[model samples]
Target: MKKLLFLVFALGSSCFLFAQDETVQALKKDAERTIQKDPNDTTSKTWKTGGFVGINAAQGSLSNWAAGGDKFSLAVNGNLSLYAFHKKNKHTWDNTLDINLGYINTTSLGSRKNDDRIDLLSKYGYAIGPKWNVGALFNFRSQLFKGYAYDDDGNRTFNSNFFSPAYVLLSPGVEWKPNNEFSAFISPATVRWTIVKNDSLAAVGAYGVDPGKHSRTEFGAFASLNYMKEINKMFSYKSRMDLYSNYLKNPKNIDVYWTNMINMKLTKFLTLTYSLDLIYDDDVKLFGENNDSPATQIKSMLGLGFLVKF
Candidate 1:
């Protein structure tokens, strides 16, 4: 059944790419028509605003994380992003700035809890005379839900109180488009900062005592490269490689992690996304006691969701 599900997702992704091509083509044609109709109309402007909202529904199992479930469970996840921007001229070199905001919410592994996250991002870029474009990005993330806990002696305890964690990142990037259908992006020195962390369980002795309690800060850097190629007139191939590291304050510890995500559009409104998450960290105390060795873990998830543009 899982194999069959994967096959379906693959097919849907292929079809979605075809639809993207058609949409882009249609937009291009419209722009050309508008330009040709008024050769001397320098006062007219060309700008576009659009985004997508999606609803995702699926059934799967999660593992590796404490408080997570190993048994089959029904899950739902969704997100929405909207933006509007304008460029002075299509041929003239002009900078474009967009304020993009989005939110995502998903059910926990046991389906008894929920995780909600919100993102506020800004992207600014300018064409450095043609094939090269440079940009900077700022992103903020907030985890807006409570977590589960157990009694001091290991008995399960539940509550309704919740806290949120905040993370911020700054990235300066460059995009090179050798031609019309192919492009690549690299962000060499992106920095991420975590301003808040959860530690209630540790204070209560459910998780071992730690030097840092309540909220703490951590600093990290990441580098990633992404390439996309247009296949035929309707499909495109996308791939990315990333490396990240973090060093936490007191109770000194470090961690490194990587993530890979592949998404295929099934249509103008639907997309299939598959992700692999991996982490490797040095000895540390989790829930209060000392974890003896460096741990490496991998997690995977696949989901289908709708994408809408307005």
Candidate 2:
């Protein structure tokens, strides 16, 4: 009877120890799953970098054909966009660059530029909540080459050159980013500087600068919205809008800058793209057939091109 009792006690102790070991292993696995990071979390990425480049071209040649058109013509457009972002913990940094240039040549019109742009932006943020951040942003916008306004008589007037009307802004703001596809920044105090470094442009007070002055400064309320989304496997769209109200000048006449891009992917390297831009500034004047006034400017482009991604 004593030996049987000893055996029973040993078996019971072994069974209890085995069951406790299984429970511990299950708990460990559960903890690991809870703490493991998700691969698709955009906010937690350490670094992300990518860009796209595209070129579109068109040409036409006519001999003795009856069609009434330029004997020879060619048009080419090129664009580049780049971005880099870093995010970790509660801090984030983003930078972007964009450029576009286009030219058209024809027997009747010679060579002229159809599009020109350069834009750069950088932002830094510290997250205060799940969807809110305290942020500071810097932006610069200008053209790459000289721009001209041609009249009906084929006479051209020099309008702009590099740095002739560069726009720079620094904003301390609050940002809301609830998802990967949308972000908005709002600032009560934004500093804007318009620079016209060219002597000719400065003499005429181009782009709202004081006469004979190379730059103008403004304090304003500013807001910006950025949204990007992939509609499906073959279609995507992105847009940006900026609004500014100058407190030192005419606050009621707001300045606006808006851009939109739509892309349709045909293959891995081929795409059809459309881009639109709209700008309006109260201090800038546009010469029209009737009078010179502050008017909204619009530009749009559509083309099929080969795209390269990096």
Candidate 3:
């Protein structure tokens, strides 16, 4: 009778231990599945940030070649772009800042500025529907250094300087965003300011401000369309266009600014880039071919450079 009782007690203990082990294994599997379903559990991220910086250079040297060109030419260009985006449920905010500067040296032209650009844009929106949002947009643009025009005699004439043609725009508008790559905004009411801080340029009424005045203000209606797309693993394109009409002045006359950029990746850190810009403003004047008037302006650049992204 003593042996029988001992065996029964040992068997009961073993069964209890085995049951506990099975329960623990089941719990572990359940926990892993839950983690696999939701990696962050309850927390969600709302911000995304990225940017890229690039530098491009070109150099050419001619000996006794028949083709007529400068004996030696060199150009260097640099550009930077940074952006931040936030989206959580019904609220969204986006910001971008871009800078570009370049210079070129030639036997005849010496050294001169080839490119200059500064641009910033910010927008905040609250979604009211699946595709529409109410938003406020702000934009600022200017150059970082002096720019000049060269005469036939190779004489340089000062045309612009830092803040000489700065532009500031603010608008409260409705935006339509179908996806992450396209957006359109329209505002019936907008305010724009043109600033020429340089005393000499301001005195000349540069960029449409009154002579001797530092700034000009206008109320306008504004519309902008933006698009970006990655065509493949190695190519991408971006474009934006803006239009504005001053309500207080000639509402029939419109101001336009358009920009486009295309990139082709050759390697992880090397890219070929092309950029074009078009601008038209009635208030801005340019002098060329003995004509001094407001005219459409266009610029283009192409280069291959090292690119770093973050």
Give the per-residue lDDT digits (tens) of candidate 3, residues 86-199. 999999999999899999999989999999999999999999999999989999999999999888899988889888889999999999999989999999999999999999
Number of the top-ranking candidate, with lDDT as the measure: 3
lDDT of 1 by residue, 180-206 (tens): 444444565667654434455435422
- In order, the Cα lDDT scores of the candidates are 0.51, 0.91, 0.92
Model 2 worst lDDT window (10 residues) = 283-292
| Residue-level lDDT tens digits of model 2 in 29-138 | 88888566688875644999998899878899999979688999998889998989989899999888999999999998889999999999898999999999998999
The positional error of residue 234 in candidate 1, measured at the CA in angstroms, is 7.9
lDDT of 3 at 244: 98
Ranking of all candidate structures by their TM-score, best first? 3, 2, 1
Question: Model 2, which residues run further than 4 Å from truth?
Answer: 1-45, 65-67, 289-291
- State the lDDT at 240 in candidate 2: 90
The residue-level lDDT of candidate 1 at 254 comes to: 36
Candidate achieving higher lDDT, 2 or 3: 3
Provide the lDDT at 235 for model 3: 93
TM-score of each: 0.50, 0.84, 0.87
